[model samples]
Target chain A: MTKNILIAGFGGQGVLFTGKFIAYGALIEGKELSWLPSYGPEMRGGTCNCSVIVSDEPVGSPIVNEPDVLIAMNRPSLDKFEDAVVPGGDIYIDSSLVDREVRRTDVNVHYIPATRLSTERGFDGIANMILLGSVIKGSGVIKEETIPAAMSKVVSAKRQNLFDFNIRALALGAEVLE
Target chain B: MAEKVLMKGNEAIAEAAIAAGCRHYFGYPITPQTEIAAYMAKRMPKIGGVFLQAESEVSAVNMVIGAASAGVRVMTSSSSPGISLKSEGLSYMAGCDLPALIVNVQRGGPGLGGIQPSQSDYFQATRGGGHGDYHMLVLAPNSVQEMAQLTIQGFALAEKYRMPCMLLADGTMGQMMEPVELPDSAPEMAEKPWALTGTGLSRKHNIINSLSLTPDELERWNIDRYARYAKVEADEVMYEEYLTEDADVCVVGYGIAARVARNAVNAARAKGIKAGMFRPITLWPFPKAALNKLATTCRAFISVELSMGQLIEDVELAIRCSRPVTLCNRTGGMIPSPEQVLASIEEAAAKLN
Candidate 1:
């Protein structure tokens, strides 16, 4: 089976890093993966995204037309990619801020309060990672334990303390569905 | 290389330059590429390399040209407007046959357009933005690894032909990060004996000037320059051909757009559409021969670019051997999606069949 994932949101929302964690996790898991980012001026204060394709065979392409797993961290991201999820694919939205609801029978939609959960867990500005937890829990694309390891590696070496909160946030989001 | 460190593209180029034996760098900082200047600023002094953040891009290029003329491996870089400012210096470098590397991390253009990644500089780069009949050996790199590799090759080729070599990168290739395995350092490679470091009292003073008083001498100089360009065209042209063996359609592109086009070609093949991609790594002295050979089997060609059909002109000229080359592009801070390219290829293919 092939899985395509797109993590997109505004510039500082950590959307790029969110996708990085997933891609790196998949790579570390010995899965064939490709990660590509949205280039140009769109990278600053604009919507930034990275598309990842993971397959058992060599990935035919890295670009994704219809992502199997979509993680939307903001309203614009939710509105833009809500319809892009492939039929029977799943989606994880930041329920804390996204007010609108999506109805699609073929795709399973999970509304998780990523921001609130992150805030409650003392992980501010990490709503993207919180949203990542929701997607992983919903999709089981990677082992829950490996996600934290990936997060720690991405957190800037200077901000080593920040990994504490991101790990806590991921665990909180994982337990919420249980 | 360097013990397997994670680095951004800009930093990688700086490291690659040093590894390539470049001890001289002069540039000013611009957004999306500031890290390159920053990397040089920190690393150059420690390694005994000369790093100068010039007053402006114009000053930077001239400094590089001067140092390079003195037989030093020198370089300078900037974005769109900055590169535009360096045109005068580039023309001088080409005219004087100075060996150097000039990097243009392309951003939007036509007047400080924007800080977005754009391949719109194809004309400026390949057609000689400066006022001259000379061409800079343009190398387009699609990935971070290629960015480093090409920078080193750019310096080497510059010395080989005694001409200015350009690294035509965009903001995407500059700011993006990826794992890169760097090649061996410069000393490991062969050395140049033509360097003007010193001629000694045994011989007359060496003068590296573009000016010639005699009309006949100047005419002969231009002819000599073209001869070198012809040799470059024959020896240095490089490209990548993928899945074009039995393909009915050929998609031509380079740099980031080329990477995207490759993915789209794979996607089209999965959908039962016979598609292939020809990515020209060298823009000037373009890999025309390769494309011409591939044209024998392909019925039609698709020109994929990020500009308004800039490289399309070149592809049409190259593939004039057999088929028509259609264009698929997105301009002014836009990147054409792979699906869009596939649709264009399919549409163009439908016309012939």
Candidate 2:
């Protein structure tokens, strides 16, 4: 099965990082994947997005026109990409940042107050991972157990101290979904 | 097999170049391709290689010419505008018959254009961007793995033919991430007998130059270079054919466009449209013979690209216009989605019916 995922948010929102984590998770599972981010001038303190395609077969187009899953981290992102999700697809919204309700009735909408949840849990600035946890639980796109190894690859050697904290945040988000 | 690691395309190119024995890197930073320079900057010093960030693209290409003249593997990378600036040095390198790897991770074109990925530089790369009659061995990679593999191949082919070889990729290929297992062992470097090494009074002194005062000698040099290019054309043409046999329509594309077209091909097959894909791995040698052969069987062709219609012209010429070749493209940094390409293929198929 192929899953086309689109992650969107403002700069500094870990939009690209969130996509990378999912890509790494898929890679660890020995699945074929491609992760393409929206680069260039618009990324300078503006909106940023990433398109990640994870598949059992070799991936074809890296650009996701119609996403099977959309993770919107801000109001602008939710408004911009809400309609692009396929029918009966999934949309994960960070409700703390995006106050607007999704108007579409065709897709599955899961609203998690990711930013507020991250702050209340004393793990601020990790709302992306929290949302990712919910995404894994809701969509089952990747194995939840793969998050630790995937995080280890992406978190970098110098920032190893944040490893456990990130794991905690991911688990909390997953539990919130349950 | 070596362990596979997920890496961005630009980073993969830089790492593969190092593994392939490239020790000198000189370049000016450009968007979508700056990661290569950044990677080289971080790794070169530690590995005892030289990485110089030249003040401008012109200076950087000149530095590449200098390093290559010393019989060492050298490389320089840039985007569209920077490539235009390096054209002068490129022509000089070709004239001097210097072998080096020049990477153009192309962005939108005509001018500085934009930082988004584009294949508009197809004409510029395959036709030899600089002035005069010359051609660089151009390799177009579709995936991040090919981005690494082709960089290695580019260096070897450049040295084998005594000319510059260009890895003509787009910003998409530079920025995308995929799992790539790079080569474990270093590549075999060719002997450069024409290098400008100091004579120890045991061998004749070699001159590395492009300027010949006599018109006849300059003409002779041009002719000789063309002869060598013919040999490369005969030996180095590379392309990929997908589902072309027993098909009525052939889709041709290179680099990222080919990847997009492949998805369209599969969709077309599901709709029973009898469509296939022909991807040119080498833009200069162009796989003309293979495309021409496919034209004999396929009823029509669609040239999918990120440029207005640059690749379509080549598709027509390759098949000698025996079949109707249509352009399915987007320009100015915008890429055609798989749906757009599929629509074109369907239209072509309808016309045939």
Question: In order, what fnat does every candidate score?
Answer: 0.13, 0.87
lDDT of 1 by residue, A66-139 (tens): 89998877788878888888898877888887888876778888888888877787778788776777677878
Model 1 chain B lDDT-worst window of ten: B187-196
TM-score of each: 0.90, 0.98
Q: Each predicted complex: what DockQ?
A: 0.30, 0.90
Residue pairs with colliding backbones in model 1 are A41-B116, A88-A106
Q: Local error of candidate 1 at B80, Å?
A: 2.1
lDDT string, candidate 1, B1-353, tens digits: 44433456788899899899888999998865777889889999998999999989989998988898778888888888888999999999988888888888888767978887789999999988899679999999887778899999998888888888889988767766555678776734335565567777777667778888899998999999999899999898899898999889999999878877887898888988889999999999899888988889998898888888899999988877478788898877667887898898788778877
The alpha-carbon deviation from the true structure for residue A112 of candidate 1, after best TM-score superposition, in angstroms, is 2.0
Interface RMSD of each: 4.1, 0.5
TM-score of chain A of each: 0.90, 0.95
Q: How accurate is candidate 2 locally (lDDT)?
A: 0.93
Q: Which candidate is the best by lDDT?
A: 2
